[model samples]
Target: MKKTIIFIMLVAMNFFISCGNSTNSEITTQKENEIVSNNEENSDKENDEGKEEQIIKIEDNEEDEVVISKSQAYLDRYFQLEKELEDSLAGKYSGTTIDMKEAVSIEYDSWDELLNEIYGVLQEQLSEEEMKAVREEQIQWLTIRDSKAGESANEVEGGTMEPLVYESSLAQSTKERCYELINNYMK
Candidate 1:
């Protein structure tokens, strides 16, 4: 009778444990589904926002032609570009860790390209002295950008996450710099 009772107790304990695991698994699945649903809703909103942001480019016909167009337009376009890159990253975000790091680096590249383009435009618009100051400031900014990226990366040095953190910092910093240039210098 004692053996029988012990066997029955073991069975009951096993049943409870299996039930608990199933419940936990179900809860995790439910949370994942909700996240996917929310992301879809956010994507729909971003697409709608994209339709409304119209980017009109200001052409420079002469070496010193002033860009009378609203700087807001360029800013809007830059925002659009950022959204597109984010969408692209989201599409590939489910991949392995290395892929995520690469996605961030690619996004950084886009920001860097835009920065160079804006710098070129400023070169045409600003006089020699103004550009000299901007040039010095830009050099300083580059140093800061690199130092900041390194500092962030050092937090996770030699770990699998180092590249992702480093690249993300660079991308964020570059994006901020792009906006600063457009807001401060573009007329």
Candidate 2:
């Protein structure tokens, strides 16, 4: 009987130790996952920063015309607005509707102003044929932008975030077009 009791105690102790080790393993796995997730988030943020810092380098062509770099002031303003939006959205879960709307409006105004500046530059610099080509390209770009914006909004259709998403999509598309015009034609 004593031997049986000793055997039972040993089994119970072994089971408890095994359960403790299993719990520790699960905790270790959870911590590792969290660390990996945080690292990936940090890497994404770094990539975004690198993109924001990228300069558009233009070279002179065979015509001997002067090459000009992209406007730093416009890039600065664009990134500033983006940072403001991110700052405003930080730590907020759902009640950022008003803030998001205001940010989108501000971004839209900035994008429109940059686009107008690009248009003015094109008018001053391009020949008639070049202007026509640019106009056709602009029309195509507008079609794409509208389609993309609609699609982005549709992804959140009937949700509270749809308007904000649509406005953000518009702003992003316009900003990208502004950069393209600056890089490709502003020489």
Candidate 3:
């Protein structure tokens, strides 16, 4: 009778230990599965938001394209004329009459203000046709002048003027374009 009780007690203890291990394993597996599912849900949410943002970008870019293209064309035309005007002025007056240093100072609070003032002062003073004609003449003159300069450079010792001198000569043209664009836009 003593051996029988000891055997039964040992058997019950072994069975309970085995069941406890299985239960702990099942709980751990359940926790791991839950964590994995949560991660998957978060990743999917992020992907959806990214796709929406890309769609918005595409839409905005489409609208911007037309405006950007038009502005680019207008600015190109304005800059070309501005360059010609500067080159003409420099050829006639060198560094004497209108100093580049003096023209760069801006008293206006902003570009918009400057433009408004310019337009207010000059819109009625010149006609659009006159502006167009002047721009055409300047472009023509610049083409001729640039061709001559190129020819002269070809005849020189190194086939090109020194970079510094070339840059100085062109600086006025660049400034003229900047001013012209501002003034024209104001108009």
Candidate 4:
């Protein structure tokens, strides 16, 4: 049952975590670069590699290049490291239901923290009007997040796996929301 739950999570999460071409026509790329290191300018502080991955996006005009600060490379590297951490933690803490719970709980906590950071950054970075729009969207998102988490947990209601599923669901959805907030709202 636990394996089934984890498998479902991995499958569901793959959809959002995988990076593909942007829907916006304005975004283009001359070439995709290997995981380049982020500079002092626009990288996650948690990046230990001292290197940031690069995600190129050219404007439709071709002449005007658009480098979205604190996005792209940051997200790429952050997501990579995040995946590694989750896998590592899951392995480290697995065996018993208690251990699985710890791993997923940690994962959920990490994602929750990232959401807070992203939300704070957006609050500062977005304009008054844009912020208002996102603020409303965020309110709606919070409701959805709770409902989704509960629904996922209910799949195994009264079982030992219930809380584990709940936390993993929260972690997965919150992680997706982090990416959504960045890609859609972040400039």
Candidate 5:
């Protein structure tokens, strides 16, 4: 009877040990499945948001207009050039006026290209009346930009930093104008 009692206790312990392991494995599997499901849901949400952001809809009495987002390539190039200019000024030139002027000049070229691209888009997308209005605004903006740039340079007249400041001002104004045109007219 003693031996039988010991054997029964061992069998009970073995059953309990096996059940504990099975429960732990099931819990682990459940946690992994939950993580995978959460990841899939987050991915779906991101895709939906991306799609919504890429399209701009404008309601007009004349027609319904859809303005697609500009090509990322052009913007990417502009940003990349700006970054390169910053890096050069900070590291290689150490903020020297001459080197800064050269760097700003390169950035100005990029801004000029962006301006041309915005102009091309306007020409293709705008009605003749709208185009004429934009052209007039652009001419006025150019005058202001040139005058401001000259005044900014004059602030440091005869100084080594004058050209650098002038080019920087021009680049900044052009960039702002590009954004303004895109926001006001493109949409």
Candidate 6:
């Protein structure tokens, strides 16, 4: 189901981001002067009112330190879409829609065709951080796709089954286009 796939993707993303951390170490800085100045100002105000001043501390979670530029975000989105398509095609999905005809429509005759096209677009635009993220995403996507393919091989029904082809092709084509765009942007 869509929920299951979404959950799986979220878990996978979390794993990707949080790998090799003891505590969730994120970037942060202390504004000593600002805090001190605010506290001092508050203390004076409280004293005039014949009351004790209470200091307030503010904390922040600074995850996602590697901020991607707008262009890079587009690239990353493309990369993610491609991954989703690849996963679906490989039947690594647990959704209600298991249209094989649709899934197979994005069949790339060769990886080189995909890689070359993607590389052409991405080699110039993306930053090092974005490139790294895309590469990591690619690996994760491929791993999921391969596992799904293996798991679903037996369950996939065979034969021409022509009438269902239109629906199947539509689904598969959509997935392929999504991945293609992503790969193109990230490459």
Best candidate according to lDDT: 1
lDDT for model 3: 0.54
Candidate 1 pairs with clashing backbones: none
Model 5, span 119-171: residue lDDT tens: 89889888999999999999999999999999999999999888888988999
Query: Which tens-of-lDDT digit does each residue in 92-181 have in candidate 4?
Result: 465788888888888888888888888888887789999999989989988898899899999999999998998888888888888898
Worst 10-residue lDDT window for candidate 1 reads: 55-64
| lDDT (0 to 1) per candidate | 0.86, 0.79, 0.54, 0.76, 0.79, 0.52
> Model 5: which residue pairs collide?
none
lDDT of candidate model 5 versus the reference: 0.79
Candidate 4, residue 152: lDDT: 94
- Sort every candidate by lDDT, greatest first: 1, 5, 2, 4, 3, 6
Q: What is the TM-score of each candidate against the true structure?
A: 0.62, 0.55, 0.31, 0.61, 0.58, 0.30
Per-residue lDDT tens digits of candidate 6, residues 1-187? 9999999999998987786452333221245566788999999887866532221111121222222343355566556656766765665233324455444444432333455455555656678887787678667766665555544443444634442344344344434544655545532
> Candidate 3: where are CA atoms >4 Å away?
1-26, 65-138, 141-151, 157-187
Off by over 4 Å in 2: 1-95
Worst 10 residues of 3 by lDDT: 101-110
The deviation in Å at residue 77 for candidate 5 is: 6.8
Cα displacement (Å) at residue 181, model 2: 0.3
Number of the candidate with higher TM-score, 2 or 5: 5
Ranking by TM-score: 1, 4, 5, 2, 3, 6
